[model samples]
Target chain A: MTADTVQSGLAAQGYVASPDLAMALHLALSLGRPLLLEGAAGVGKTEVARALAAWKRCDLIRLQCYEGLDAAQAIYEWNYPRQLLAIRAQGDHADEAKLFSETYLLERPLLRAIRQPIAPVLLIDEIDRADEEFEAYLLEILSDFAITIPELGTLRATTRPMVILTANGTRDLSDALRRRCLYAHVDYPDAGTELQILTTRHPTLNHHLAAQVVGFVQSLRKEELEKKPGVAEMLDFAAALAGLGVADLSADPAILQAALATLLKTQSDRAIITTEVAQRLAGKAA
Target chain B: MRGAVTRFAARDPGPAARIAGFMGHLRANGFRLGIAETETALAALATTDCSEPATRRALKSVCCGSAEDWARFDAVFDSFWRNGGRVRTKAVPSNTTPAKATREAEGQATSGAGRTDASDSQKDGEADTGGEGRLIATRVANLRRRDLREVVSADDIRLAETVARRLGAALRDRRSRRVKAAAKGARIDLRRTLRASLSTGGEPFRLKRRRRPDRPVRIAALVDVSGSMQPYARPFLAFLAGLMRADAAADAYLFHTRLVRVTEALRDEDPFRALNRISLLADGFGGGSRIGAALQHFATTHARTHVDGRTVVMILSDGYDSAPGTDIGTALGRLSKRGCRILWLNPLKGWRDYAPVASGMAAALPHLDLFAPAATLDDLAALETELARL
Candidate 1:
């Protein structure tokens, strides 16, 4: 699909991407490269993958990355319990060949994505959290569109799965990893974009209240807060405001305080964004 | 920007020449553009509409190998394409006088023409006008060749940053033990081949071969932020920041009397902002050097977790150990035992008469795989190239 069509499709899925992101996605799809999206936490990096999968009507196979994420967890693992049961039950009749067959193989997200008859969207979320070894492990799969299992040989995808790798930039990625992917850096949206995103996501939210919430969050992001509010937080804040039946998001201390917890995640951030500061931000946003 | 490129194109009337010149300019400015990338970029430009955004998008995808490459590509594209028109706009009066004035003002500030107090600034003024396009290309070339010891002014620092950023992105690859099945390989995948033969009643019809792929070498930067390294630390960290952008697996730590992990701080895209954050975060900044103690601290705390066979530990310091009898040698010995390659970078090595005279230097030298200067942009480029070879 063209950039314009991709943008339209993404918009249909309620995701608003910048021109650069749209272009990057378009190129990635057309060129058959993994799209690497880097951004701060909760800035819709993973959501973009979901939206794409949803738009394309494909299964979204997600691999959530962590500190010690390894190939066994990400790719495939032998069902040891099942194999052991077969061994015990069959006695001398237990076939070693049958025990290590496809029936015994438990496919993880990566392998599942690869083995799908139809191409699926494979989302590797927060890839930077994975250790260097695991990242290195992914290079072969990413570049060659295949996985190797010791027991099962090489499983190369007949239809290439659209791959999305999202990182919060906690750690640097390898050059090999970066080179294999088409890159996009997703940041917090501008005030107008955030406001639009808020209203779009929470269509029932009052326009004035949504603006106030987005503005308040934008102001907070400008501050040196340890954990600034992201779009997800803004949505939560709007939902909270809706719950409170606060239509205008007035600078009233009680109303602001009630919904404030939804936006600020950390105690230090909450401490910094005092009632006084909220009132001022609300007043300014108005 | 598109209008500027269009105007320049109209005057130049040679898109091929202009594009080729831009490619050369990119190469000269340390882009590492391969022949394939150049061909791809050219083909992209040809097939795409000539609109500025489309052109940029096309070239970006085809030409850039990574994010760092994309950034440099954009910067050079802007300068090389727009600056062509900008020179003409300055010399011959344009319809947009205000725009011309604004650009000229920016050019003066960037060019550092008036600040001739420094001899480098004097050289800057000579290349500031008439040959602005040629000037940018030559400036980068000159900056790459100049020694870090000669860099004294802010202008030189800016140039040094540009060079450092380029060097940092040029990361080296290392062989990994991890093997994957390939179409052709040196080793037979017995397990995989056996597994595939199950369909034919244990009669092998298909063969599977495995090949080991090259993995990015993990770079662990231990920068000394002591007073002795004050002059070199900032640029070195900036270089590390560049490496951070290029290689996400790269780790950074700052040490003076203590070792402080600065990997988290260096996540900022802006190196200046990262430096500011580092200053606030690391207590070791501008402190006294305790090389042995810091190495011991790192070895005890972070080494086992971060350093491995694939890791290359690069120490950026002057080798001034505050504690004389401290066993830096033993600490380095421990790190080497972990199978991490050691590279000691001393700024003093940039000096012509410099030697490894310091006690800390003497102790650590035996464990080092590579001992190189970290003082200048040239040294950084050389170091990166040398690492790539290893």
Candidate 2:
């Protein structure tokens, strides 16, 4: 997508368009290299892809990967039950047509992304979670934009899908996969950007109120919380603050705790930042 | 005073907030670097003006490599400004008071000794004591605790921190000695000197010039993995992983009752997963701590296999024994005499009153060249810095 469209679209959504992010996205598109975004979870790596799809007028295809994932699970899986039933029903006269039709494969995310007539922006979310074997399989698809299937032979992409691979750095991705991808590591937004995020997502929030809320959440990140809040949690917190009409620090303790659910995602984090700290923090930040 | 503390805390709220979030747990137990006192220290450092050398030095001293950590302390202190800790917010606190007693300052071992001057360790009485004509010795004495179970909290981060501090102090002593020796004339060896002279002059009389040998220290760590150490195990492994990353001459082994080489396993990116891999490959995750078996196996079998004179074997455990695991002392004595230093790292050593009650502790104490604690994150970091000196 054009830079103007990206800038305006994200602005319309209330998120400030960072020049660094824009440049990285533009460079990835221009070079035809897949973007590898590594960051602490929820630092807007996935959001970048969604935003790109919105600005580019393309469909967004997401492939969620987990442990013990294999090539078949990623590309396509043959309908075993249907094939079994067809073989039994076809009996003596079954022949080639029955066998071929019975073995019809169901397309998975990778094959769908590769075979699409119009390329979509594909997000292989949590790529680090997949095992080494599954990662090796992606190397060819990532580079050549093609995969060899025994049944259907090499399936070539009509157009390369705009790919974004996000990793939480749980494990190191193989050098081969990383070699073909452009990379960036996103960190938590600075105070002003968080305030801007609050304004974008919850326009009803007062300017100072949004800053105070962002400051508190940022403070929470530093405070040895069991599970730290991310950018999404910050936005959720701002929305909560706006919903409660908490324009200033004079809000009741109950109102503050009510907003706690949005920011403190983990029960442990909430418990650690007990009602006392939250109240005191609110008083201090306000 | 209130306004400055508030402002100071506001700017440096990150580490404070983290500690403050669990102040109750720390306060009730009387932990040294409790949330409130850490906040007070954080505030004093933050608002005192970085333009001043003392403030800047304090800032550096308090910081733990992250802006977030600084901010957390600031935020916590800000709340303390509104709340208040055991420390007074007015002016400077007493120099004689133990850092633990000061609200604005957490318990620092060097508090009574005054500010740390990197270049002035000799005058400050923290200099190396051995192998010199004049030795500057300051008693940076051991923590009162002698046993692990009684003093050490099950919490890994806290344990690692305390251990790191003690280990760090000891390391500084070892390093200062080494540096002083390395700085002056280290006498050249003459026996093998003739071998080099025969090649050039066929004359055994002339001394060939040689560089002073700085032998690389080999460090080997063995951690207990019995149920008692379930909490500290992960952080211990993580701290080991960081040491490995620093390319420390270190190898780590885990033992529930049987020792397992976890060197390759901990090489993985994720520390938790690496520990899991060890637990699975070893499966020695739940028996008794075979201190004797572990040490004997290491000394006779392991140390002989990979170590020379400069090796340092570190044992991280509570020293609990179910079996007659005290037999490992003979092997330790053998290893120690062979030029390998045996270090016993007890997490309990950080507490007020700890004793070596276990058979393992009893057996191993006499043989150990150093006894340290690895009970807190700071302890871990200090251990790292100390080793870096070595």
Candidate 3:
């Protein structure tokens, strides 16, 4: 599909993707390459895969990466307990080839995505948290859309799934992995986009409150807090204000400071944005 | 689209030459574009609507490999495409000297060896001629090998920081407790093997084994910013920033008469800006050296949480103590009891006739696992190989 089509498709799915991001996705689809998305913690990198899957009307398979992730957990595993029961039931007639066949094979996210009849969206989240050696295992599947097992030889994809890998800059990925994928960097949405997102997500909310909420969150990000509130946090803050029936941000100082639990994550962050700072930000937010 | 694809094909020499020239310009500006990336960009350009902005965005996705490269893509694109394939000298300072840009581009391809040769040639050229060009080249070469105390130029400091960053990214991995499946391992994985025995009729036919995986080593550096170490503190802080970038778990602290953790400040994406923030944070700099009290403060406050057996505690100081009766040996002994390795990087050791006869250095010498000199960038580069052995 063209970039414009991709943009419209994602917009229908409520993902408001930038033109550059849409273009990157279109190139990745046309060229049959994996896309790598890097950004801050909560800039909606993972949401892109979900939106793409919804737009494509296909399955969304997720593989969350962490330290010491290995191929057995990511690609496939054998159902050993069932194999043993079959061997016991068969007694001397158990065949080795049948035991290791597809019937006894358990498919993980990677294998399940490749084996799908229609192309699915595969999301590898927080890839930087995995060890460097784990990246070497991904090279074969990413470039060739295939996985090699010693017992099963090689399994190629019936339909090559769309792959999206997200990293939060915890560590540097190897150059080989970076070279194999199309790249995009996602940043926080601006004030206009944030307001659009809020109104879209909560359609019944008042427009004036939505503008004030988005304004306050945007201004609060400029403060010297340890963790700046993200888009998701902004949405949560807005929901809390609506639930509390607070129309104006500067009207209730004590309630605004208490509602910061949805925005501020750490104790230090809460201490930084005191009542005075919140009121000042609310005054400017008007 | 078919006509556009045909026009951009190799058979048509005009667009092909332009694309190659653009790729060359990108490479000169430190974008790593190999043949695969070039082919992808060309294919993307041919199939899509050929608007200039769309083409630039498509090529940017294909070419950029990191955040830094992504940030630099637009400027490089404007310089080459908007300027009619002529890279403006004002936009890119590296392109001002064609020879230097070409040399750096070549150096990028061969990695480390080509850069060493480039620096060596500069030194050799300086020995032959007394011209202004040769003099500047000589100064650039000397900056890498000169003592940090003698370094004064901003350009030299920037170059040294870049080298320090590269060196820090080469940190070696250490074996961790987490295990992965292996053919032969130190211990048997009973859980996996038991599960595997189902195919064999409850018989343990094949044994499953596991071995420890490798993770990046934890590092905590405490730099002395006292009066005596004023000259070397900036360069050492640059090195510390590199380590923090390489491993996110790494911690950094600065101390004079008191200790202040600057890990959050040094975590800024810009190294120069992080150094400036750190300089403002450490208002106690240029005070009298209090190595003993600083060590005591770290051991009492932060050692329990940050230091473990896998950690390497690096103390960058000259080991000169202004507090006479303070106890340094006991403080080091407490850290050593935690099973962490302590390393001392003394800039004073670079002197030809320097000795560790100072009371503080003599008391702490026996507690150190490694004592190395860090007077120049070359010495810091050498420490990479030394750290690998650890």
Candidate 4:
């Protein structure tokens, strides 16, 4: 979409994206800068990457991190079997150049993201989860938008990919990685925005029903709950009611309890939510 | 679409169908409202063409309920959807009619902007500014993450006050052990001397140096077993006995409103049992703590007779004086001047706004040579190390 039309498209779908993000994105596009988003979990950290890729029509490349994640998994590693076969086939005839060229070049996400001709959205989720060593390795590539393999030499992004990094604050991220991109933190929506979100998600529900569900969920969060219902949970609860065809809280409390799988993960949370309090609001299920 | 209708009118197919369609749209566009409610809200939304402004406003209101919840949700929505989904509307040229442009620009700033793009108006007189900080606090205070047990649970590890007590007790034990080592001279061997006298026809009398008595160190812990120290009593005593095992002279004592020497009672290996025994031994162990009275009793009855300048006094209490406040301070001051290195550790001071407010704290605060925050296991360790230093 044209710059002028971007706002209208979002408005049509019921979103109120701020102008600062628009300006930051525009500058990022102009200067080829990556965007870094930091925030709490379940606050739509990855959604930004998903939404950007959709809006810009680019491929989304994700590199998921956990303990013990290493450079070979992120950058590139050679195919062992292919390399063995090439070595056997060549025998003494092949030198380092010939044997190495054919089979010893397997690419990982970072290389794949850069090597692709089409610009892709590279999402580094939970960059803070990886250890300091992994963070350091990520920095060289992030800062230069390239990778250096001893065999392959430096492979830079011919067209720099639009990168977005999301962290959940398990640990503080390195300043170097943060400096390479524009930073933003993604918190959840406010009461009014959440209401819009519910209505936007579940159109069949009445205003009173939607408002009540949001109110109840919000109240539940304040209580020392086993698990908090996020925006995702609210939507799931609302959608579950609409599917059951109940329009108010006065009917069908059981379906709300039964649909507990959508919002609550643990059985204990479901037990707490589906009791008398949930029974009161279950009439929203038509 | 024109005016208000009965709640029954919402059941009509045209509006319901439209609502259902919109719910589907919401799902497709990626709002995770539950399966049932998605359909319900859609049914409600389809009944009328609520103005886009009103609908958006209503929708936000419903989804966002708590001040804390909305702040976080708004931040996430702005960051993810805005950065990733559609871009913002283009600004009209700055050269456009100054009056209208300025008015529009001013209108946009006061709305609750999240994270990076808080409007100038919001930073000012708007409700969002003063409230935004609170919102951040509330939302962040309840983060949704995997239940990392250690991070979520309120640990029962030593608090700052308890740590200080344990540290002081440990130091006192160390000092008492040193004093016992010096003061315990050689014991006279009577049997050997008599055997020599028999050889010399009963007139000869000589004595041989014998092994000294292995008297262990005694730690008279004048701990305040008052209701105020209930939470800390268990941990503090455990730490006390654990420190004493390492020191040969350490004897543990506890008090509430009166003095009771529990040196023999808490000789058991298990800390909990030892504490229980001491609690039973002390008369005021379960009563309101009187630090002044306990100190006065120990000084008169036990000071020169049982305890002496060699004795290391360790006081483990929040310093709450049930007696007159001035007396508690005077008594503690006198006790300190008598060669006791007074170290006062308060737990509440570990908190950001903790001030010396309690009468006990006021009484004892001035006498403390070493004041520290001993709120956690680490703080206790720090307290121990400080004792070791002394």
Q: Give the candidate number with the greatest DockQ.
A: 3
Best by TM-score: 3
| Lowest-sum lDDT 10-residue window in model 2 chain A | A94-103
DockQ of each: 0.13, 0.01, 0.42, 0.01
Better of 3 and 4 by TM-score: 3
Q: Tens-digit lDDT track for model 3 on A10-59? A: 98888888788999999988888899998777778999999999999999
Of 3 and 4, the candidate ranking higher by lDDT? 3
lDDT tens digits by residue: candidate 3, B1-390:
333222243566676667887788776544567887777878988768988778888988889887656765775676565533242322223322343335334534433321122222121111111123234433432222211221123344565556655544554465776888776798899998988776666788889999996655578899887667866755676577666665677788887666767776667675544554454344434556678877886885567567878778989999989875236787898789878989899999989999988899988999999889997666777787777666
Model 2: per-residue Cα lDDT at residue A126: 92
Model 2 residue B182 lDDT?
20
lDDT of 1 by residue, A168-202 (tens): 65666776777567677777899888887887798
Q: Which ten residues in a row have the lowest lDDT in candidate 1 chain B?
A: B122-131
Q: What is the TM-score of chain A alone in each candidate?
A: 0.96, 0.90, 0.98, 0.83
DockQ score of the complex predicted as candidate 2: 0.01
Candidate 2: stretches off by over 4 Å: A1-9, A12-17, A84-91, A101-103, B1-390
Expressed as tens digits, the lDDT of each residue in A108-198 for candidate 4 is 8888888778899899888878777888888888778778877767878876788877776655565456545555545566667678767
Worst 10 residues of 4 chain A by lDDT: A1-10
Q: For model 3, which pairs clash?
A: A83-B198, A84-B198
Compute fnat per model.
0.14, 0.00, 0.57, 0.00
TM-score of each: 0.59, 0.47, 0.66, 0.45
DockQ category of candidate 4: incorrect
Candidate lDDT values, in order = 0.70, 0.58, 0.75, 0.54
lDDT of 1 by residue, B299-332 (tens): 7546756788878898988898878734799899
